[model samples]
Target: MELQQMRYVIAVAETNSFTRAAERCLVVQSALSHQIARLERELGARLFERTSRRVRLTPAGAAFLPAARQCLDAAERAAAEVAAAVGEVRGRLAVGLIPTVAAVDIPGALRDFRRRYPQVRVGLRVGASDDLVEQVKEGALDVAFLGLPTTARLTGVAARELARDRLVAVVAPDHPLAGGPSVSLGRLATEDFVDLPAGTAGRIQTDQAFAAAGLTREVAFEVTTADFMDRLVGQGLGIAMFPSASVHRLTGVAAVEVTDAPARVEYVIWSPVGRTPAAAAFLDLLDLPGPGGSAAHAARAALGTR
Candidate 1:
């Protein structure tokens, strides 16, 4: 029932070993066991199944885990809010971003954020844009950086557009199109392509462009990471369309402008209902320019600015 007991339970559940959990919690094995036993007695159910070989959560423990986590998170957030009221921002900041994020240097930004808010713990997750947006909406992430085709729409979250970029065609140096003049979508569509997995935001942007152009293309290779996509292109496997800003950073591939290409908008999204103090501080550090003024004003206008 106590917050400390909940913390101990989480540690045990995560480590799956009472001895390891005790080490993780910086408590003796006996004290950790005693506290968990006390909690089980109060709840009138055994939380764990202890055997000579292993310790695992019982059905009741599994059912109680999520609620326990929520309660602990709530308590921590409350304490963080109290500290923020007096000008100290100390909390966990969970930030999610797409792999091809170019509008802001993520590592640099994290460095600056850490320097400015040394007390805050920051965690980074790299994922697809749609997944990151869902995490933000679900409150699993405090904020997220996303890239979506201009034609796409986002709902139920507050967002600020960071930048807009046009995708360029990337080809191997020995390929036919390398070093050639800018190519049209029609011409590029004829070539094999290496792209992110189907249905991903990055892939969908190019797909929509091709569809709009009355064209269809083959994605010969589907890879998860941009590095692998670059490797495939360098090996003459296929061509790819990626943000123009990032193409220059890739070696062994030549970038050709696409006459008719897809454009993606970068955005930073957060929950409109519960804006954490740490998240607010990070947003302020960005100091992004909105359509008319600061990013703060633009986010208030929702997706209407973009």
Candidate 2:
């Protein structure tokens, strides 16, 4: 019934350890347990199933988690709205970014945002695009910059395209394709490739493009970071593909345009529930028009700002 109880439950669910959750919430283990017990008793449902090794959410807990997050988001938005009325943006803003985000100057934007609202606390989380999108939907992140297909349809999230960058082939300067203006996927079918691991946004796009072109390459190395991939290609370990903007400044690698390759679109996505004043201000820094109009206006309407 109390807001603190809801927060405790959410913390426990996220950490899956009562001790760690209590530590994160800045409370004693016993007090956190007691609060959760009281909340379970009030609801007449077991929210979590505890065992010796791990704590797992029950079916009821899984179902209640979204509503609990929405309650917290609504409370934060209400508080932010009151502060925004006074032309003040002071709140925690959690933003997520993909590892290979290159189309936007995120660091520069953050620098500007800090100068504009020094009181706002900003937290950044870096991960793959899919992971970032899930975090935004779960309310763990207020906004996320993701690399996605141009036609990507994300449920429970509102996304707006920021910029699109063409995918290009990267190779060592001495490689056979390095001197070429552009290379076809079919030309590299038999070549060794350094690629992102499967399930990442970049890998998925690369795979789809190859599949569409009826070409397959041997993956000699799988790397998680773009810089690592570039280094591998520079060493002649294998050819690789990445966004043109990301590979333009590499020293030992040459980025050749990929003939007929699909472009990856960079999108800024957020939960549709609402945005805190700090989050809205950060979006304003991006100057992105929402799917309909101004993203800031949409956020204000969602937050019930007057």
Candidate 3:
């Protein structure tokens, strides 16, 4: 029987009189009597022995009483759990990010967001942009930071452009093109390119730029991870192209300005299928000015770069 029916049976058993039980349950006596009668009929057994002035439990009623109480307790516990999940901010939110985005600004920004919303339990996952897109689409992640134009048409998801990330040249300190104010596209043509893999947005941008400059890409090595790309460049493997944000000094790589490359726009991609309040809070966090958000001012203060 239904949980409400169990509750009705329990109420009638607790109070001896039908009228008293209905008053306690905020139902009319006849309605309560009818519900108990229906329950007894469904079970094919009498639950109570009724007299003119009093109601007492039958053998079947005594057997069912504990079970009825247990059913109601379970139902109430389930309801309370649902209410906690909905009303509280302290639930798990799985967030995904690509290496470059995670390395650049997201880590610091997330640290700040965690400090602000400590009640939220965050689960962070890092992967390639395409992988993160797939995770978001498959409902594996609540939210993700990825490059734009996700496979939403194929998978039913959407993206919002959060910030613009531009490409820049990266190389070792002793490289031949290192001393220039700005290396011309024609001059950069001769250097072997330590490149990103073919499918990545940065790689596509580099391919287009090289084609426009009438320069052929002398493929040096294919490195996908931003950290590894910087490391490969630092070891004098060849010059690599990456978003300016990943230019943070980590593995002895040096970042230089590349004016001719296409800009890489970073976007926040997520599925709304199972969004929680914490996920919305994360979107709001993206709009706030955290550590490096005012990059111009923060950069000037840190690197003294004009």
Evaluate all candidate structures by whole-model CA lDDT and list the values in order: 0.86, 0.82, 0.67
Q: Best to worst by TM-score, what's the order?
A: 1, 2, 3
Give the candidate number with the greatest lDDT.
1
In the range 50-132, model 1's lDDT, one tens digit per residue, is 99999999999999988898898789888877777666777789999987889988888889889978898999999989899
Stretches of candidate 2 exceeding 4 Å from the true structure: 49-54, 150-156, 249-252, 289-306
Which 10 consecutive positions of candidate 3 have the poorest summed lDDT?
A: 288-297
Off by over 4 Å in 1: 46-59, 288-306
**lDDT of candidate 3 over 214-246, digit per residue (tens):** 888687788777778777778897888667776
Q: Which stretches of candidate 3 lie over 4 Å from their true place?
A: 1-86, 102-104, 115-119, 148-155, 272-274, 288-306
Error of 2 at 140 (Å): 3.2
**Model 3: pairs clashing at backbone N, Cα or C within 3 Å:** none
| Cα shift from native, residue 185, model 1 (Å) | 1.9
| TM agreement with the true structure for every prediction | 0.87, 0.82, 0.60
State which candidate, 2 or 3, has the greater lDDT: 2
Error of 1 at 210 (Å): 1.8
